[model samples]
Target: MSAIDVRALSSVPVEPWRNGGGVTQTLATHGTEWRVSVAQVERDGPYSRFDSIARVSFLLRGKGVTLRHRASVIRLAPLTAVEYDGGTEWDATLVDGPVTALNIMTAAGRYRTTVNPIVVATIVPPGCAAIVIALDSACRYSEPDIGTDGSIQPGQFMIVISVDRPLRVEPAHHGAAPPLIVTIEPVPARTPDSNF
Candidate 1:
């Protein structure tokens, strides 16, 4: 959980939701503390609730969808993230057809997460934990050989971070699509000492 790890998307097992609305593949986890996953929405339905978690989601494929909350509707576009409480009740309406989405969730107050879409080469600096996902096509890495020879197929991912230096990432050679970088940081503990 403290260092870098790499994985293939196809190797993960997909679990169907209890409501049968979609299937999800969990790529990584810090045990019960947090998780990163990708989901395929096969139909319109309500999302599952996670009482003490913070959820950030991004649309990876399909036209997109509108998340209907109690008093508002949030439209999800490819690569753009919409963060909300994991306990929030929402229904999804597909804009076109089936949708593929990525989700980053952390136990509230335990960690912080940020997701960014990259169209060109990107450098993941040292000191933080990060996960890189191939979005458009396959992705190429500068070194440390994640996936296959520094390349991972679209939807495949790698994680594990080195505190000693930064890692560079780039798109595939032809018809490339931007990849996404997710940075995860531990939230500093709050004390009665003072307001930070």
Candidate 2:
């Protein structure tokens, strides 16, 4: 985890959802507790239920999409994210056509993940494990501490830093779009019955 792990979307194999409504290319995962992936939403359908987990999704491509969650109709657009209880009964409707998105899910009571739009030249805070996802164009990054540097094209992403260690991230060059910064942090310990 200390060293960077770069994963390309095209290099990752696509796996169909259990319901077969869409497909996903897993980018990174830590056991069953949390996972990051890019999903291709080919059709509107019910989302699979994942009890005890919370999901955060970012619209990466396509026109947009809307979700019927609880009593609310949530809309999402490119570069935007929405988080909800993973077990909720929800269905998706394409705003214009098929869609692609970045998805992060963490087991409730175990971990938490946040997706934010970061400005170029910003340094990742200490003790933060992060993923830089290229959105609109290719971008480069460097970890001076490790003397390592790399680049990822649009739609690709890289995971750097460890939970125990922090690293600085600077944009290598300018691009049309900024990358989506995904920060992973652990939740405080909770009593067995506290989350229930």
Candidate 3:
């Protein structure tokens, strides 16, 4: 099992040369075969230029934003995740106010990610990578027998074991407030000779 605190993620300044926009990245990897980055969008402008990349953005703070992709426009609110192909032409507009969003961009065909809100106790199937991003400090997670236990505070996250066996996860006892968990899973790999 591995853990990553969202607050501990280092910030990389957005480069204007790459695109006519302002964005900050907390995690970024540009390997020869794969490209992935988790970023925070502080300003709205033209989207990044990467023909074969997939992007997932979740609003973390402030008002939501409306993303215009080709002829499709999607409104994104806090905790809401919006995904699209990077090659598509897209534009964004601040809706309520300045927004802070969590973004994950990866090589188009190499990988894919899904973002969803988790509440209540649940079990994670094997061969999956689970990322729980806590929205409230009152949230907690525990796995019996497997010995996985911890609490997720605001701006913090945890990743359960990467395995092919199912794992259990229980929410800590909190009278009222429900914890929000975000799970990220990489798409299953294909055969060696398969075209990505």
Instruction: Report the C-alpha lDDT of model 3 over 1-196, residue by residue, as the tens digit.
Output: 4332333333334543255445564443435433333444556777665688777777767778787877788777777777777787778788755776767676676655666555566776655555665555445555555676666665455554353455555555555334444344567678899987
Our model 3 lands, by Cα RMSD against the true structure, at: 4.6
Q: Which candidate is the best by TM-score?
A: 2
Mind sharing the TM-score for model 1?
Answer: 0.82
How far in Å is the alpha carbon of 136 misplaced in model 2? 3.9
Ranking by TM-score: 2, 1, 3
The 0-to-1 C-alpha lDDT of every candidate, in the order given, reads: 0.78, 0.77, 0.59
After TM-score superposition, the amount by which residue 11's alpha carbon in candidate 3 deviates from its true location, in angstroms, is: 9.1
TM-score of 3: 0.68
Task: Please write out the lDDT profile of model 1 over residues 23-120, one tens digit for every residue.
Answer: 99988777777788899999998988889999888888888888888897788887688887888788889988999999988898887788886667
Model 1 residue runs over 4 Å out of place are 1-3, 142-149, 153-155, 161-165, 172-174
Off by over 4 Å in 3: 1-40, 109-112, 173-180, 186-196
Better of 2 and 3 by TM-score: 2
Clashes of 2: 0
Error of 1 at 87 (Å): 0.9
Model 1 residue 56 CA deviation (Å) reads 0.6
